[model samples]
Target chain A: MRRTAPITILALTCTLLISMACAVALGPASISPGSLVTLPNAWMIIWDVRLPRVIAAALVGCALAVAGTAMQGLFRNSMADPYIIGTSSGGALGATLSIVLFAGTGRPVFAFAGAAIATFAVYIIARQGGKIPVETLLLSGVALSMLLSAFLSFLMYTAGRSLHQIMFWLMGGFWNVSWDDVIVAILIPVGCLIIYLYARDINIISLGEEDAIHLGVNVERLKQILLFVSAFLTGIAVSIAGAIGFIGLITPHVMRLIVGPDHRVLFPAAALAGGILLLWSDTLTRTFANDMPVGIITACFGAPFFIYLLRSRMKA
Target chain B: MKPVEVIGIDVSYGAKKVLEAISLHVERGEILGIIGPNGAGKTTLVKAMSRIVSPENGTVYLNDQNLDSFSFREMAQQVAVVPQGISISFDYTVRDIVMMGRHPYIERLSSGTSRDLEICDRAMQLANVTHLAGSSVNAISGGERQRALIARALAQEPKILLLDEATSNLDISHRIEILNIIRSLTGKITVISVFHDLNLAAYYCDRLIMLKDRRVYAVGPPEDILTTETIRAVFGIDTFIRHHPFTMRPYVLPVYESPAALGSARRVHVVCGGGTGSDLLYALHREGFQVSAGVLNIFDTDYATAAALKIPCVTEAPFAAISPGARKDLGRCIDATSAVVVTAMPIGQGNIENLRILEDFQDKPVILLGDGGNPSFQDCTGGEADAIVRGLLDRGAVTAERIEEVLRVLHGAA
Candidate 1:
């Protein structure tokens, strides 16, 4: 109950809206606000090309952040995120399988199934008795991620013609997004809302599973619901964009410092900040870097920040 | 109906059994304490009652209903548990932690109401943590954090509260303060707590269930359960149980004795009275000496110590001088022993015979225990007792200052 939580959430929300407008307007073929009105080609560029891409990027970012925040709370480890826990890798492999076998017909469904299975696998592997120790959970996630990546790599190797599409998807960008993808991304808000309803339970559970139980949280069921929802969100993000990495890892952590870890405030704040972050990252790559994969820029910044977190946590 | 009843519950972790066929019941508003040595399954029993661990073979009943029939929220509304301690991963404020106690009542769609906040504030006040409401749980001290947890448990407004050694980690003042708060909750909230400190359990609990080797060893009021014999049998230590001066509750004082040293089977008679010889008697007995003390009146403090240690004593009646029968018994005790040790006790008319009898055993090695200075024999019999001591000293009676030195001299003489 920090006094500044509402203010922080409101401020991040406004910032995210502004960032989304700038991202939609400032693409490679920059359409000015005046041109959007008079020029039909400019209007088509804005409507068909840039608008859906920017909207999907923002929604995917929100999904990843909400999933990450829930994960950090569920594991009671600040370092946990959808990407770190093999959810994204599982989604990547699932998408790659659909691309190789069915020509990407029902990719989101396959991705979601894969993500859910991987998350539950990691959970079962890490659990000892009734508790999941943080170290075991992290190590199990790493092991599962490696195995999923291997499957993804094998799928890419056998597909000669669709290899380029798989490679581009794996690198993660919104260059080919459309209105249909935007329609699918609408599910992100529904997932976020469902998770938001359990924000208080997440706050109690982060204290520890046993304390959560004492406080009337159904700890095992809560863990299952959170993991399923996080996998759902991660699966959708991967299906729309690609296996984007650190928006899930870094945004929730930084927002926690500002909004002070009440998941009610933290979930919204992290979601908004994550949307702003990925919107700007996508904007930067498409505008200046000749539409390179946005995941490269994010990882370049995310890996170093992750190392800093590790070092600081070690000192603590 | 009892507020809580367990019907021969057995709990196990994997293949290891923690509690075996443990059955108990709690009255409506009494504080029932569970106490035992480590690994005696005290905490596991609490866990079973709280539904943190389901019993493998038996059922727990709350308000005459099977425990498993209630949902997690319903069970929490009925029973609140205060664990020993917890490390919060997030920086939740004390108020935030306490407000979580109202979760079972609050619907998922709505936040805590003004009434919930009122209960939180009242709970904080009762736990003496009102001033710390806004502080982060991580920033507070351990004792303060423990109190905040108590505040959280209080805010639950539960019908039955289970505490697993909740005050065991705090200091004496904090322990008493928190227990006092819980004690004030009696007649409204039924409490079942696990206690490591037997004295606190005795002082705070209305009744106690003592566990030994995973079974219910004894259950009664503290005065009846915390006896010298029961404590000796359960804890395997000698305890001097007495009523507290103010509360009249049983107070346990452990008679700290090291293991008996090997190869010393010699007998030493301690000539002590007026509580001077208690420590010496304990030390000698711990050192494997077949020690005996007396010609002591039945009411002497040393006589009590001797009795507690199970040392053979030649006792006289209270406030009585040494009788002929006691004197003859004392002579027999000294003759059977290898050495005599005279502690610094007052030489009154009633006990001067304790020193006079020392003369007959002159050839036996005699050791005088002094107060690290001169052996001040408080001779109320004037020069007569002093002359007898002087005669013993003239006949090579050695004087030692402390118990260690007395033990050394006795061992050397042996």
Candidate 2:
């Protein structure tokens, strides 16, 4: 197990790097691999347009994947994804509200604030004697998701002609992602690293709270730290990417099947896998259907694969 | 000095009080067993000692320090708890589970040290789970899973260990295996185990604290705490208490349920002695018959069984000839009962009077489990008791080969 861990990590890092380079080469106004060494236009296009978009996609993917893994570990439920905790739904609601009320100028900022507030609400609702019991957290997350989604539906109902814009944003993409977006999305890897530092404690918590407490884990504190960091990561990712789904939910599961459930190894692997998956999905969305949102491509491809994996795992 | 002392602690789950003002001290390096019927607060007490559930009223002291003063890490280093009935759905291997015990000591970035691995290896070896180190915890049997969890607790190397019904899921052999491991740790680690099985608790625990209705009913060595009267009062069931022949510990056998509905059944007087009538007495009592036995010597096994079953029995002094007063008392009992059963008890000189009482009941229906054996072999009075049995058979008393047939004849007639 020890020998396999380092090797698995190295392999994932390599996969992420290779996939990024390949993704940069595949978009519209395609430049040949050999000409890219000399051509100034290709360099200009890669640096000014493609590089920032790819960076944002990678950040969003890594953030969602790491957040999903942490949430799954926090709740000790296999089905606990980033969206299960109301972060994405809250982000979508904030983005739609901003688009309707403020004309979409500060949509990312409002979305980030909404994600943070939603997580804080869930955390406060679930807290009892400083401990956030998993069942209570899960229920609160579900309830908050339901409440926020109802509000979002009301906004969509009022959005008549502009409903197309709201719906397209909801489908999620990185069409106009900029250097400013990349700067804000940098917190994804930073938040993931913080959560990774507590991977051992998270592993113990996954055994159950009482078990973690007896094993000397400050279970309440660990829950607070991991949930806050993951929520922050999800907030930044959702603010920029406009609620990309499945990357966070599916990446951790794929990594877990390959590397086992030890969060120490699974966290980083999920981040790398998430980055590679989103980078390629973004490249395909841009190359094949220029107007299509990356979120549609992800759900179009990721959901069927997730069901296949689930059915196969059940058979095993 | 005692290492753990819980002083007047009360605990509640929401509005329902689970434990109230419970005070107990666990001596250092002793296996203290907690026993009680369901809802008796046994698990609550263990949780209190481990500091899992904070007390509403009082304090728990670990060594000389207040338990509340210790940080989570310090408390974990001193105390470890094996919780009951935890289901691990994740596919963590046995070694992965046990290695979690080192979480308190390991640094944030460090995976684990050689010392941690050594401790895990020793704990698994002590728990007899070294061979299962690679197996997923959920894939193992209940007994093996229990040992793996115990191994995890042992890896923590706590000075005090608390188990909450840790062996309830195990069968007898596995239960013994786990208890034997715990027994060997008696002098090194203080153990407070909640046991569902009274017999196992009596056999393994150095001292027992029996709980009744959220309070300590009795606290002492098993011999004193496991008395039949205590069992009846606390558990509300009639039980037979006897010293285990090897360990000399109190062993309890439940005899019958409450006789609320059984009191209305027909009374059957039994004539037997020397342990032969014990099964018949228990079966009849459990089958809802109001049973009475006769003239058994005070020290006879049959007498103990009858007393345990709470059957009304006429008795005689041990090794003494049945006196005329006792015979008259036996006669009164025989006259009152509707039927009588004579079990295959050997009649010695001292108890031959029981056979003579059978002659008085000749007019009443009597079922004999003679099994065609000569009564002279059992007769100590040189064919005197044999002649009484033969005469009874000739007088059209029913002859049955087994106790079941006797019950059939009597219950059928009823």
Candidate 3:
């Protein structure tokens, strides 16, 4: 039992830095490895362009994984990924609405605003007083996701000339990766990770509200904070990258199946696993496809395995 | 004033009034037992007492203070309840659940203190479930789970303990162990427990509360509370009540059916089951003939009724399974008796040899009830049963309808 977590974090940190370096330095017209370090134009491509995008992927992956682990503990159900319950639905709707309504004016900012508003709306509608039953939250998230998707479709139908562009973005991508977008992704996810360290409180909570109250936890206050922070983190990430689906849902689940149910181990394990998974996914999308969006790549690769999980779970 | 008193408390679930303005008292250091039939509101009474369900009318008090004045947390601190539904949906460990009981005591912004842990540990030790301290509560045996729940309430460190049918699911040994534990807790605390088993209530409780028709029917010592008349009236069952030789406590024996129901029986001596004695006697009586049943306790419902009907009944004190003395006495009864009938009562390792009495009077008739098609006789046979029962039947014994038909044949021969 050589101190499991610090070593795990160190391993993840090494993987992340290696991926960042590769994301910047590898391509068809590869910048010379030596020139890449010194040449102003080459450094701009490596540092200003690819570096931000790689950082954004790593941050968003970390945020979703944290949210996934927290949601799992909060619901006390293995299946409760952040994307499962309308959190992603709210994020997608907000981003779609912001793009359709405020296009060419302020892309990331309005999309983020829209994401926050959608999350708040979903939370208010789904919660009964202060308590949100896990079942209701999942159902509402799915229901609202469909409703939001329909609304996005309606926006696409009316936008005419911009329809193709909106559709393309909605398919999801890291193609528009830039330094500013990277900063947006980094700031919000980092803030959410700070909030997610509070996920330990959820370990005691998921047992029951009454049980949590007895354990000297302010159960209501903890629920409010977890809900807001997860929503806030997911909203900002989706605002930048559209709805990249299974990295959050599948990564945390696989990590849990590997490491066991304890969230203290699960939270960081899922974050690390989610980051690596998306990094590899982004690499595969960029290198293998014809300018393929990251979301399509994830669904194409992750969905078949996800479907197999559902089938096996149903059999069990 | 009593430390705790109920003044005309009533509880109703929807339109059904389960408890009707019931009043009671619990002085400090009293081990009170509540005994009743299945739907007699035993649980309703305990729940109302604990304030788990608020009574529709009347008041409950602790130390002359009205129960309404106390919040749930305050009441929890004063009179902790180990509720009947001890199961949890989540897979929390025993220590985790016990620690939850210390809720009313834990300091602000901290986990439990050393004092809290010590209290929980003491509770587990007292309940004799210390081995299960780290085990998942959902996965443990029912007895272990019940002990854990009790440990939780004990950890609450309340002055009064309220348990509702808490020992019902346990085995005989566990039941006695739990009852003794409850009885011992009365040194400084008041313990109120509802029990379905009357004999257990007799052995352990200091005072017994008998309920009928949503009201208190009797309240006293077990000897006073467990009269045959009360059992007949409250439970609609005829019973024989006697004093135990040692404890001198009232012992209740439920009336079992007789062998008189059979139209004809060569008097079959059922060395018999614990309860099979009743069916044999009933079968013998219903045949409109006299057959003796004996060496059974007067508190053995079958034995008492046989005595009442002048069936030459023999008796002994309330004991377990069958002892060697009981076996020899049955032999004496068999020497004078005719054929035998083995009722379909459970024939396990304890009393399996008891049924072999027909094998000895090898020439005598032996009828085993529940042998053929009847479902009641299902427990009578096993792997070697065909040979065992067939051997007895071969010696001129057979199956009869409730043992009465066998006796009619004996009467006809007479």
Candidate 4:
């Protein structure tokens, strides 16, 4: 392990804690520390409005980043993320269906079911003679994502009144988050813990499947577990925050550069850093941009960083 | 029981058959080598043993237990395979990769213990990668990376080690270094390796299994298996097999002459003795010349070469003077050939008649093969051999340096 890994993780943890505190205090009606002590309205705003929203954003961000890190290692491709294989589109479609048909009741359950089904479908489609080759898995993911997005577009066209709500949810924000959402986000850490147990296996498997087999990894089983868990994490994060873009894509990548590729260090480092990143992005939108969707800011930065990665990979 | 035994195993990838009814066994503590040309299923056989590929027809028994019965972890604890090479996607330190070998032992809930660390260190030392333990696998050389892989396999502390041409990608010195390391592990770890280099296989392996068309063509000690005929039949190449001077192992020297390049089919007689004529005989024989050699003793190296090439040679008893009978055979050879080539061999009383008889063929196109600067004949017959050589030179015998020059002169005569 790099000597700086623990230090980086500690620093990210501190940064995440500080960022959450600042986010909770600095939204639209900025409440100073003194006002927090004296004003009942400030206390109500902090407890009922900003606190749950900020905490859910951080938790959802952690879930996405951890899932992204797992996906990248599982596929042995640095470009892989939870959404690259249709999880987000599946969740989005499910969420859209809920919005159009039942006015967003049971949206999280629908989104998770959609995400899990889509991931397994991709896995099954990509399997050839009992092995899931990464290239085929990736292609199957893209194909399924396009089909799910077409379904999502059709649902949006039919929903006349809930169209505005669907568009806002698709853009993705934390304005509607509450304590109940935070309770659901608690499952994120449990999922992260499960993935962390396989960090060493992931390290071995990233070398290649054949090498992994030689090293005693039950490669097919490990692939299934990682895919299912990552999809679970991404599904929960999408259900909670409406598919926040690039927290999953960009955070794991940037943290990998800092902490190196040992998933033991990378998973936690990316989790904290991702939480910090989305926490700050949500804070920026709600405090300064008049509650605009945080996904816009994330995508504005994420797409370019992704493009840079592609160009640099080409050069390499 | 044998350490590894495959019984009537037929392996295939999808619908394409790779190994057909192949069976072999490795005794405990033997470094068994699998050798074959490309597409011979050597690697696939290794895969079958490691349980990477299951055989379609029969069973593999490891320590008399069914290979299918072993869990993946149990199998890894028993066997470790060092691949030809691996391209790691991450920049894992050499230590991290080595430590991963301890994965099968380390429980999923616990990190590697201090005992595991000690094993990893020892493995690195054995593989001579201790100094590179902290270097990124990608930053190191190919040879170092392969050593790290060896270290990783060693860290598994396996009872059986499998190498799939693991050293094939390295240079000669690295290959020797790695093989020596592996050789040092023989009595403790049973090894089954795939070899592309026949010389390395002959030198290092305790026994070799030669494969052809996805079947075991031959299996025996190197001395028995690496014969010119077996190699020619299996690899379709002409090889000169001889004992290595230092190791006494059978050394294979490939006769790389392309038969199509010089297929003169003209008759040539080589008059040589000692070991000097072996290369010339091989060259002439490979080029499709109807070559005959000697008045050589039965024990002469040239006689052996001639025998190996299936050339018609006139041979006498070892250490005996050229008799009247052998001289008659030599005369017949000289008369049947269009050109006669005499190599730079030591002349002695026993073989002096080989030179004196050449004097009778004065009209024949004679090429004296010599190393340009030196006297071709080691004239231990004193002035007698020198006088005969001078007489042959006077009668228009052309001295050509090197075998190619001799072949050019003979071709010109043709």
Candidate 5:
């Protein structure tokens, strides 16, 4: 268990690094070797535009995956994802309102607040008596996600002027990612580190709440901290990448199958794999069809993958 | 010294009260067993002791300090619990699961040290799961899983270990295996376990606390707490209690129900002695006959069985001759019952009066079990007891070769 993780993380980091280099060099109007030797234009585009977008995608991916891992641990369900329980839609709704009202200055703050509130709302509604059964929480999240998404759709329909910006944001892309965005998005790794600090507790919590408590975890406080951190991660990711789907849901699951459920190993591996997965999807969409949203590619793949997971888990 | 003390704790789920005003104390390093029928709050009481559920009105003290004052880590370091059933979806290895018991001691962000791993290794060896350490916990059988959970608790090395039906899912051998593991830990760590099997609880637990209707029904050594009266009262079943010859512990055997009910109105009197009449009484009771037994010596095994079944019995003082007042009571019982059955008890000087009562019941339906040996074989009065039994058999008494035939004769008379 000890030796397996560092090697896996090292391998993933190397793959992520290699993927980033290839991705940065291969956008629309690919930088030629001769141009790389001759002019500052290629250098400027690679440093300014491509690096920030890749870095944004990587950060958002890492954040979403870590948040998804935390949420899965919190709910103790294998199929739990960030967006499955309405966190993404909540963040989107908050950002959309900010885009229209505060003109995007408070988008990150509002998005974080919105995601946190939605998570708690679903949690509060699902809790019966004293226990929140996994099935009840899953159903409640699905219902609330639909309800919130419907409200978001209504808001988008009414906003005639900001429809394009809302559509682009909702489609989920890193087209306008800037240094300020990167600074706000740095919370993804910082939040992941905080989650890592509680990784052992989360591992026990994933077994069951009663098991966690009897094992010496203050379950209520651990839950609050994990939920807050995960929601904060989704909020920050949504502020930059606009509800990129599936990296959070699939990354941890894939890592768990490979590395097992030891959170000490699972969390870091998930973060790296998530970064690589999103960076690959972002590079593919930009290279093949520059106008296409990264969310489209992710959802196109994620929805089917999620259905497969649901079906297989049901059979299990 | 008391390691755990529960004081008037009340626990309820929502509006339904599971346990009310329950109190108990556990001596250090003693194996205390908790037993009750379904829905009797056995699990709730254990939870309260471990501080998993805070009581609405009472407090739990650990080593004379309030349980609420301890942080979760400190509480876990002192008390380890192996819950009834745990389902794991995330495929954690058995070693990974067992290592979780060391969570309270290991600081955050740092894995277990060499000493912690050594303790975990020894714990696995103690639980006999060292071979299964690397296997997925979900892939094992129920008994293996139970052992793994026990190994986890052992890894914790707490002062107290609480088990809630920990062996319920296991098979007979595994049940004994887990119980034996607990039995070995008796003097080293305090154990409070809930057992559904009364026999196992009686065998393994040093002290047993029987619960009924959300209250402490009885609490003492297993021999005292596991009496026939307590079993019948708490479990609502007729059970015979006997001392295990090897361990000297009380063992309970439930009286099996009869094949079919003859009629509730048919009443029968049994003339039995020694241990021969106990089975007949159980058979008659199961067949729905209102049964009574008599003139049995106080120390007779049949008398104890009769008492356990709560049958109205006429009794004589042990090793003494039957009194006239007891004989009068036996006469009334004979007049009231529709028929009488006699078991093959050894005829003795003290119980010879029991044979004389047969002469009066010759006109009635008396089912007598015939053993070929004469009553004089056990008689101190020479051939007189044999002659009396022979006369009773000739005077229109029905002969039965087996106890089931006695039940048949009663049903026939009914």
Candidate 6:
């Protein structure tokens, strides 16, 4: 188990850093290393524009992945992802509304708030007595996300030029990347990850509620804390990066195969894999075009992989 | 060894009260058998004791300490539970599953230690399924899986064991084996098991607790509490209770008798012979035909069956010849048979009076296994009996061979 851990982490770090460097270096301007000494814009572009964007992608990726991993174990589900439960849509609607309605308000802040609200709403609706039932959470997430999406589209349609202006944000871009946004993204995700790191208490919980209580876990309280931490990360990540699909949905799944369903390892492994995969996806995005949204790239790949995972694991 | 006690526990499923103010204690090193009719709240009681569902009205104490004061790991160390079924949807290997019971002892941050392995290994050894150490728990037979589950619970090294109808899903052979295993644990730990099978309860449990309508019906040593009246009240089935010849302990048999009016002059008696003829005597009694059995040896279950029927039995020794007094009484019974049916038990020296009925009764229907049945059965037949069988059959009495056909003939003839 120890050997498996370091090997996968090494593979993950190598993948993330290599992809991040490539994504930052390879863009529409395609500035050369030699020209870095010559051209004035190259240094600012590399350091300010591409680096923060790259960092933002990595942080958001890691956050979503860790949050998704914790939620899956807590729910005892293999396919639980942020988008399916309307977390992203909720965040997207929040981001779109804040941008269109609020006027010059920071997009990431509003998006994070939206994501958190939607998640807690889903959590509350799904709760029965002291338990957050898997089926209820799953169904309510679907319902609330759709409801929020409709409201978002209504606001977007009603607005004139602002609707088109916020389109790229809806499309999910890391383009107008700033150092401030990068720091905010990293901080929110890191804090959430630290809390989830403590949720190994959830493993005893996944055995079932009664078993958990018998084992002396304050099962309900632990669940509330975990959901809050996970949703906080997911909301903050979505606000910063838009609804980048595959990292949160698939990273946790890939790690569960490497490690058993113990959350202590699963949550960290998921965060790492997420951060790496987002770096790779961002690289693929940046390598293709400067202005393309990472969400499109993730959806195109994540959907098929989700199907594949579901099929393969159905037999298992 | 102080018993684990559940005190004044009340359990509710939503608003419906399933178990009311109920309390029972399981003494250490005793296999306390719990028997009741369906919906007797036995499983609910176990759940409450285990703190799976905390009792709404009362507290459970382990020794004298309040059970709620213990941590989950602490509670696990004191009690192990083999729930009704092994719900293994995941294909966890038997070792992984068994090792889960070591969760209380296992280090949270690292793999299990060798000491843990020894405890888990000893549990598997006790359950006698070490060969299934690497097998998938789901693929094993019901009996094997049950034992594997027992091993997992035992791996907790708990002082108290709670089982909720653990053997109900098993076959007869498995049931016997499981009960035997539980019986073997009598001196080591407290075992509270819910059993629907009363006979198994009688064989295994030193003491039995009977439940009815969410309340305790009776609790005592098995022989003292398990009786005809209790079975009738709890299960609403008419039964007969009689002592085992070997153990000198009573067990029950369900008897279904159809109520039919009979004329005062038409009283009847059956002088049944042979051990296998037990059912025939029962069928006769249930039909409102008076039944007497034996000169039967007490070693036979049929003697118990007969005694249960409240028949005026001319019982013999446990493994001995019939007494002269029994023989004479048996003759009086024989004279009263409106129709005599000789069940096809291989007759021998002690029951020669079973054949004596043939000569004295001149005119009546005679039923035998005919020629194709066990010829060993013919060994005890004398000259008068054979001639009379031939004479009676020829005299318009039916020569029915099989017991079913004889019953049919009797039914039509009556």
Best by the lDDT measure: 1
Q: iRMS values in order, in angstroms?
A: 0.8, 1.1, 5.7, 0.8, 0.8, 3.4
DockQ per candidate, 2 decimals:
0.85, 0.72, 0.07, 0.82, 0.69, 0.37
List lDDT for all candidates, in order: 0.90, 0.84, 0.70, 0.88, 0.87, 0.73
Best to worst by TM-score, what's the order? 1, 4, 2, 5, 6, 3
**Model 6 agreement with the true structure over A1-316: per-residue lDDT tens digits:** 2347767667777777787777778777889999899999999989988888888888888888877776776665666777767777777877788777788377666776777777778877887865665568778987997798778778878878887656665566576668877877867656655666555456656656665554445666767677667667766776676676766778877787776555656676777778878777777777776567888888888889978966876677
> What would the per-residue lDDT of candidate 6 be over residues B1-414, giving only the tens digit for each residue?
356877788888899787877877777798888888888898888888888777889888898778889877788888888866644423455776677777777655656789989988998988888999878666899999888878877888888888888899999998888777767776787898898888878877878988899888899988888788888888888777766667766676666664345622333444445456677766666666666666778767677667767766777777676667877777777777676666555556666666665566667555654435422255555554555445555665555556567667667766
**TM-score against truth, every candidate:** 0.98, 0.91, 0.66, 0.94, 0.89, 0.85
Name the runs in model 3 displaced over 4 angstroms. Answer: A1-33, A102-144, A161-173, A177-201, A208-229, A246-248, A251-260, A287-291, A297-316, B1-124, B127-142, B145-170, B177-303, B306-402, B406-414
In candidate 5, how many Å is residue A115 off?
Answer: 1.4
- Please give the range of 10 consecutive residues that has the lowest summed lDDT in model 3 chain A: A208-217
The segments of candidate 4 whose C-alpha lies over 4 angstroms from its true place after superposition are A37-40, A124-140, B258-262, B371-376
Model 5 over residues A193-226: C-alpha lDDT tens digits? Answer: 9999999999898888888889999999998998
Tens-place lDDT per residue, model 3, B122-145, is 988888888888787878988888
lDDT of 5 at B225: 89
Model 2: docking quality category: medium
* Superposition error at B234 for model 2 (Å): 2.0
Candidate 3 lDDT for residue B104: 67
TM-score of 6: 0.85
For model 3 the local lDDT of residue A145 reads 75
Tens-place lDDT digits, model 5, residues B141-225: 9899899999999999899999999999888999999989988997889999999998899998888998999999999999898
Q: For candidate 4, what is the DockQ-based docking class?
A: high
* Quality of model 2 by C-alpha lDDT: 0.84
**Model 4 lDDT per residue over B54-169, tens place:** 89999999999999899889989999999999888788999999999999999988887899999999999999999998899999999999999999999999999999999998
